[model samples]
Target chain A: MAVRADDIPVPRGRPRLAGRVREWLDQESILGPVFVTPALLLLVLLVAYPFLMALYFAMSNAFIGRPSEFIGIRNFVRLWDSDAFRQTFQNAFVFTGIAVAFKLVFGICLALLLNEQLWFKRFIRGAVLLPWVIPTALSTLGWWWMFNSLYSVVNWTGIAVGFMDPPGPNWLGQKYYAMTAVVTVNVWRGLPFFAITILAGLVAIPRELYEAAEADGAGPVARFWLITLPLLKPVLAIVVLFSTIFTFSDFNIVYVLTRGGPINSTHLFATLSRVVGIDTGRIGEGAAISLYLFPLLVFVVWAQLRFVRKQAY
Target chain B: MEPIRRRRFLTTAAGGLAGILATRVPPARGQQREVSYLCWNNFAPASDKKLAEIGQRFTRDTGIKLKIDHVSHMGPQQAKYASEVQTQAGHDLVEMRMHFPWLYEPQLVDVSDVVGELEKKYGKAISSAYEGAHVNGVWRAVPQYHGMFVATYREDLFKKASLKVPDTWEDLYTVGKELKKMGNPVGIPISQNYDSISTAGPVLWSFGGMEVDKDGKTVRINSPATAQTIEWYKKMFRDCMEPEVLSWSDASNNESIQQGKAGWIHNPVSAYIVAKQRKLVTADGINHHRSLGGPQGRHETDTPRHIGIWKFSKNVEPAKEWIRYLLGKREVYDEYIMSGDAFNLPVYDKLQDHPVLRTDPKYAALRGEGVQYHTYGWPAPPSDKVQLITNTYLLPNMLAKAVTGTSTKDAIAWAEIEMRKILAG
Candidate 1:
């Protein structure tokens, strides 16, 4: 037998295993797949699988722990007849619309304010994120106490300041007030995300643009309207898109605060889905309720991304 | 030594893997036997502690290691059950409340044998327990204990105002008015919560209202009886309770009475038990009254809890052993019940007069004399449809709508349509 390198026996240990792994990874195709396999597995297990399961469940009469039959679009169609579902559908739009609008406006103002050379800028910036950083469920519990009918600090303060009647508004009890309270908490918790992200966008705006505008005799308002607003469009569009989806799907604030209560006025699709699916064991209906907005949301994402691309390029 | 080729190595590895797969057992089969039980954090905290202590004793005596986990009673517990059932995995045993056995019938192990042994040793399980766990003529769970809703009121406040304890739902309105005027409103939650349904169920049943007929198909929410229930709630909402009742959770009523804010609340004895346990200032002042009656009959909401073994559990025998150890033994069962401070009462007919009731004179109302206790959606079996009606909160929402300005007729119509839709679906 001619001496062959292949006939040589290497050490039977980690080095051999490591050598095999290194050899496999050295190939471009193998390396690409090896790197992607984990993320692909994760997406399949965590996201894609659940999403497809939800889609199937939405089309079937899937009760928890029970045999189910395919019911086609009946679940989706039947959901329309429910007053609660109707209210939830309307509430999702209202909640997302109002919350995103407020977050955008307030986020911009706060970002501008933070962009200034204020004292303790770093501390102020960090403090602004407190609402967003704290666990939503835990923080919402605090807001629940403040909005509690029996012991409302907001009511107490309002009374102390002689700003309202003796008894303050039933923040989480009545329909309109409960919606306002939930929207208010959503805005509070979400403002920091908008502020920080917009601030990054604000910072990325070259100082030269403002200086040139100023030199052109443009007032501060004019400069902002002409330069800053146009430049921030992409960031704002992306932010608004994410915020809209998030607000529509918000669960904790409504669940911990009002539980979509006072006649389901504050119910978002997420809470309604929970009530229908897990609480009631109508997993099919719950899935339908949650996925009801999927088409609309997809449109929103596509439209906003298109807007962003337009601005970016 | 011969050098191993990749093909030979893969062949041997594949053979070993196939052997393991065919056997359907882990390669390391020397692990100790263990059983895990998932229960809710009992309203009486001491009961949870007692459960853990008993679990340790179970391990020591049976040599089967036991693990216990508790989630919150209502929403979280239900969510946990759904997740477990959907995944076909989790703890081997679960504590089921009310109609959960019906909802999770397919997933639960048939424990008729265990329940039969328990019934022979103790007595027949209470009607509520039977209704809850006896699914489709099979015992899906072993009846553990029950906590019936009672009228928890401030005795001191009633004495101060010289107000008569409410005997009926109508009488409650009268006293409720005085209670509100005294700045301590009656706290019967009418929101999207089980407590809301708990109170609403009794009130509706008393007024001869049934959400669904006994057949469990007809939507009877539009009946005159239901309208009467809604009207009563509207006035009660206007004159007696605060707008806060419209936003209360299961714990809100408990907290209201415990904190001396509400003069009265409809809840289990857990409210007073917690107050007494915590030595709150209002503990001594709080007392229980029998559940109020309605025009149809005296009906109350009973929350019966049971222990169930999952069908998917490999350690079924060990799981059953834990239940037998916890509830099968008389002394152990009594000790466990006593630890609840009357919040968790024995569900057996023989133990109805459990000494835990005598633990405090305040618990006397838990006796629920002559008050027919049923779970939510009574008159109709706790089928999945009835449960859907209950969970959808049609009852509370109807009352909420009526109280919030929607016409009683309109609200009742809305609820009827919703109920019929669910039943038809």
Candidate 2:
């Protein structure tokens, strides 16, 4: 039965004025929107405006430090038809999909490992985050050294250990290996954040809930599925969302590791954008590549948010 | 007595006035001197340390302050300096990256006229550094330095393979194929954002490719010479260069050579300094030497980098004095070249022609044989727009595309279109 107006329950210690304000605020989503407005404005100014400017640029022939001629979608049309841009689009999707998928699986496994009680737990915890804690530039440089064709320890180890033939693999050399190397570097750098987030969620899970499940004779996997996962659903949703955006837009890994590759095998949006915009000075085309990444990003964000809202306790 | 005293006073006053006039007029005839230096990159790389030293010496010899704000090399560093210039900065001297010449030429005080005066006072702008800067009805630059390219190979590998030193692109290719079968790489820098003009010049000239006419006219994207050279270059990569070469845009690939990972390359003559620095070669150890031409018949080497007074310099006299002392002063030039801290060429062409160059029993032969005999940069693209061609990526991309199944006709057409667009802008 629908509660009658007079029978509605008021929150404890709520004054009449507070109740009226709450009702009004609730109806219009007033404070909710106001709480969100700062972020909204920042996004519009920083992300949206630059993006729209890029979109506008993509419709014309523009150069760096110079005025552009309006060509009415000619730049976009040309870019879309071009082999380089097409390859860039394909690369972005493949890289993000593969990277995110690996991060999710690896992140969960890492989170589970870290959740266990072990000696030097705090030290081990900090060490696990060393990759993420180091500046991207420095660590990327370290990776570059490690992957150097002649001087690489990785290559040296491979050859010495009879892992392969005489010359071992140049981790960043061939087309296929270049992509794999780039993806591996990216996953290695990014997995820490997700694992930490999930680990935090795992910690917050009530001991009583697991105890109760065990008392009811629920098996290990059943307890995980019924209680732990259901509880962590909100956290995992947020984790996937954050990692997707980070992995999708990372430029430094691709740049330092492979720089697209021997055959454009690893060209992603950001590197391709720089090549076209800064290097070639085809500012319009480069802007177009970045702008194109937006809708796909938006779709992922929306899906994540929807999943998050559904999982709220 | 009173009449005598009045006459004395008048005589004293007149004498004082005469004394003041004499002092003022003599001082007016004295001259103040100024020196100016340009920041053009090709020449000024060595100019900085050498001039700073000379500036210190000049201060000891003559009482004058030296101003050195010429230019930095192109690519990222000059971007820092360009912002300073654009905002109406009073740059004293800058190490100019060529092509920004358009940005600097009009702004700098013309030191061309003063260079000849300094030459008489000292000697001609270090004879060999002069790649004809004062011709074509324009007097803008003065001569500076040359860091040319030459061919280098691995001694151990070449000895084992029993391959002769490559004379041309074909021989380099042959050597690469044979070496690669042994799992060694021919480490030619296919991507030359590292030494764009120096590296590209020798390869193009090795196959006899013309850049642009010294008089700026049109794009020569697919000259038969350039096309043939590119075809050979692609084969060099295909046969010898490792997958790592594609990943590198800088000297990391050269470092591969130093690390003993690769075999032959057409590299900077400066590679000798690298080998020595890494202790790969010494009075005791073995190392390879590069000459002008390779197995290729006709060749080109880089013009020694040239220094010019930026039309922008404030201290033309001091700059001119500093440039002169650095170039022609025997002690200064020798100190710079022998240090091996930087790549420096001799001031006099005759010094290079001595036993030290071709027949120096100790110094490895760099005769006319493999050395491409052309010089660049003292005269290059007249405008900054055309200067884009001198960069590493544009041509290499075109060539890479062509080799990776991009049809030559289509490739040339596409390259020309892209090049003309960049050149025009």
Candidate 3:
């Protein structure tokens, strides 16, 4: 029963225009592209355009409000000579390394604790996400107030409790202490994200493995070490990957807390880029600073995703 | 005169619209005739409110509609201007701070005529304003107002201690030691902020050290004068100030004095103005003295704000009208200046003795009779490179390093290298 299009009966009150549209939409190739066109357009306009522009700016001698020319990799090469840029490069690693490590350890413990049968589990789980739920800049301002040199409530409380000497440590005034303050705030803000994602991974782990381990006369520690740890590898990998990128590019905490101060000790790539590019009107150098880590980040993403796929298969 | 018909009306309307679009010109009925201005959120909140009110009145008096927008004074304001310039769009006018006119000279419309007229009426613009808005022998922007750094101190404490008002930076150091012993340390910030640069510039200039030579190319931070300036700061940080100044924001010094912690601070009169407005206990105790002098001469940092019209703006004429209305009219300008509570002052020679100064006794320090006020880069022309040095916090960082235990010579060497790199680039 091969039917021609002309031989098919048209429905009553269906206009020819509507019928033609319906026929076009019924085809997979037409409908697929039609549905995806808006999203593809948005991605091109929003993400790809800016990224390509930044790429161009990074390689060119672009100053704000002035005509620029493409100058090869000179901007990228020149940034290496700057002490601030070098300091920023080192700071980015130290900040991300310490902040992410703390988040991972704390996240696992929190997720493990959350997995147990506890009272008011739903309420407790919701409450744990408060740091991540609030806006980063707004929440960081609260942290700034706590760490302020003049009106630091942290020092006041510590002195009141006899836990610290009067006036306490200059958290934001000293380079090391400023770095510590920024990292502590970063970990506090990012922990909820890691914990919640790890919790989801924890929920998906089958109970049968633990039961089998227990039947084999395995202890609680042995069961967790052999079963729970191995199963959470892929999820942990994904969480760490995201956290590393986010932490490396972090701007708000350090900006509000130190403004990359105490001698550029806490400047991440993003804040340094803003200083060189926007504040100083050297958009070329600024873009270069921002994109300096792009290739490395891309490699990290690729390697992590490949590892994730290997685990999946 | 023919009677209108439906077909004729449609044809006429379509043709007119096509003509207007092709020519990129609107018909009389289609033109909105509006201009927008972008400025910073003033330290005095009332000034921002007064600006809005004046904008409304300007709209009512003139046919042109005016819109005013304010941004946070520090990072966000510069970012906003950069974005606008990059996009070739945004507000028609921007309130530029200090050497911003030089930074965006190409994009700013030449408003020499407006500036010339105002100059004739109000004597010449002050030296700092002239340095700021006058770029490459042309008026790139109209000088609006200036806020100068003055020595804000506790008068009551001085009276109680029977101390002489310090006339020189060295004298202040002598008095500052006693003030610290009395539990109120000097609150000069050595941080990465404009205020840090503000105090550092005057201190450096008064000691006759400049970041760059007047040629705007030679790195001059490595000088005997700079060493003396650093030595002054090192001693000040060690004895007269606390470690907290290293972390202070622009507002922190103001808060330190207003909260009765800081005995003296190099700042504008905003601190006392804010305290008086809030009826703080320290308001009565606070008074300002003329900016302190050094062995060379008296000097201070002047923050002159200007209005610049973007080259891309279609409403240039309307924008100029707004500027003339706000700044050219003496009474309107005075009303606006009065709202700033002496934090904002006239930047013209004739209007230097503004009535706002007479309103408060604490504002007398702002007169700065013998002090030579300069923007961030004093001897050096405020070119983009000099601005870069200021924006990079090289001066403050250099002082910071010195005060924090890096030898003054090493700090000066570091700053000289950094400045030379910027200048060469």
Candidate 4:
């Protein structure tokens, strides 16, 4: 008996092969994974591979062009004994903490101001983003020149304003000043990311809530504390979490401006890792130095995510 | 229809696979030869242009292609060299300076044949060249030229201060103190800069301090001599240097002198050359002198340049030929030197009197200055450990710590510990 065209199983031909794939991909379970495969593969290749390699290198006595042998935790033990490494750890925390705190406060203030009615609002918003948009290395070079001991523009300006004496404060000469200078640059570069992201979240908040709060006789500060902040918690949490990680691993601002100079006062994890791994050819130790912050960052991210989820409930 | 579709699918899949496989196969080549070089940007732009022109000439003379890649002479270039060594595939010839030849010796091709040929034509290579390029009875690299730290000073300021050109480290301290009082401070970088190491080398050696013994087996950094050197540095830093020296970069000293803020700076002639070229400082205002003598004797640090062919290079023969062509001919070498405004010095004794060195009165003192030049490791053969110490700026860090308030004993002790760890590794 002859079958109709639709009665057969499409003959299992090449065209049917494509149809079967489409049918499989259309299923919810398969579709989710199929859609995510590209990103998953990318993460595996770019992130997971390098991370595993770093882990391997950290546990071994590795150098370029040389065979490596497993040395276990000796690198970490040696680093723990090093004063320089200890200083680096302290610096990473101080740099990231101070920078992120200031960035949050300033970002919120800037975002609030931008949210208000003002002349040239578009122009101001765009101009405020210039520091963030410019390449970090290039901008750090500019900062380096401005902080030059002899040709420091900051000193010249200070002198011109009659606020500073002949030799203005050596912005990066002293350890404290170097830390402050690096932190200042980090805040300057990072503030815009916080502001822009917060601004986006602010815009996303419903207008009805503020009106309702105003109807209940809530003042501006109270409304912000009660409504705006509660609503912005998720965005702020994510922003701070990411900024903390980025700032902790910061290298360019420190490397270009001071190169962990003035006795390594401003060395972040990345710069110290570079000094050990690439410069000194102690790949194992360098890898260990870089991984020092990974655990802390993971804990921070995990805590932030859990906090955000609880807030949602 | 089903059979036809199946056939098409199989054919397409096979074709795709074949195409991918074909891409993996390298194309056949004839006798054509090509080589690439990675080098730092020259002190003089014209020198780079001249090098490029010479590359073109080589391509014309011999039916081979030459490509030159220039990178900034800073951390990135070092990273690039490390990456290249790790991969074992990159530019055929790499321009190495200071401790790199020793650092990458295992991966470098022995260029003894080229060195021998050049030595036959010219006289023996300079001591700095031998110290830097030759290691373990093998000429791992061909020494090109070395940049020495000469005392580039403002003549008018010295005369006004009644301070004769400093001949000794003591003179520098006294003169620098006087000059500092006169508002023109001496700019000896005390930071983690290459110049800091260069400046410290003379002081450390002149005080008879050594980082490692000549055998490259023992650490000799912590000693009475080292403490003495640190004491001198502390005094100089307190009296002559502004606190800003603690944060200065490699280019800071040059800028300080060119901007007329410094009375004296121990740097290569590039600063003076740039000042004259840019009319930032007059020719009469600037002069060059020998680096100050220490208690033992006058010694200067040499930033020696070397040309090394990678062992993995496919065109090692062509790369060596190009290096020989550049260094072997006196006229070619002289032209290159002139292009650099006498910035590049001759490594061979025969080329020492090249007219480029004598034509300029300011550069007169720089002639044969390589005689007193010493590499970073000084007494020790520059081993991998020595290179690590130099690259990590251990000496500068120790001096910086001492000058910035860490006690001399503590600084030296710390450095000795660091040195021991590196040597042990």
TM-score of each: 0.93, 0.70, 0.96, 0.93
User: What tens digits encode model 1's per-residue C-alpha lDDT throughout B1-425?
Assistant: 99999999999989988988898766765557899999998888889999999999988998899999989878899899899888899999999998889888889899999999999988899999998899889999999999999898999999999999999999999999999999999899989888899989899899898888888888878888888998899999999988888888878899998888999999888888778778999999998888899778899999999999999999999999999999999999999999988878999989899998887788888888898989999879888889888887889988988898899889988888888888887
The stretch of ten residues in a row with the least summed lDDT in candidate 3 chain B is B383-392
Q: Each model's DockQ? A: 0.69, 0.12, 0.74, 0.53
**C-alpha local distance difference test of each model:** 0.91, 0.63, 0.92, 0.86
Stretches of model 4 off by over 4 angstroms after superposition: A1-14, B1-29, B368-371
How do the residues A63-170 of candidate 2 rate in per-residue lDDT, one tens digit apiece? 554467888766555666555567778888888889989988898889888999988989988998988998887898888888776677887887788887755675
The DockQ-based order of candidates, best leading, equals: 3, 1, 4, 2
- Of models 3 and 4, which has the larger TM-score? 3
By DockQ thresholds, what CAPRI class is model 3? medium
> Candidate 1 DockQ category?
medium
Decide which is better by lDDT, 1 or 3.
3
Count steric clashes of candidate 2. Answer: 51
lDDT of 4 by residue, B356-383 (tens): 7777888887874533788888889987
**Model 2: per-residue Cα lDDT over B75-144, one tens digit each:** 4444444444434444454544223334345444565665565466445554224433443345355555
Per-chain TM-score of chain A in candidate 4 equals 0.93
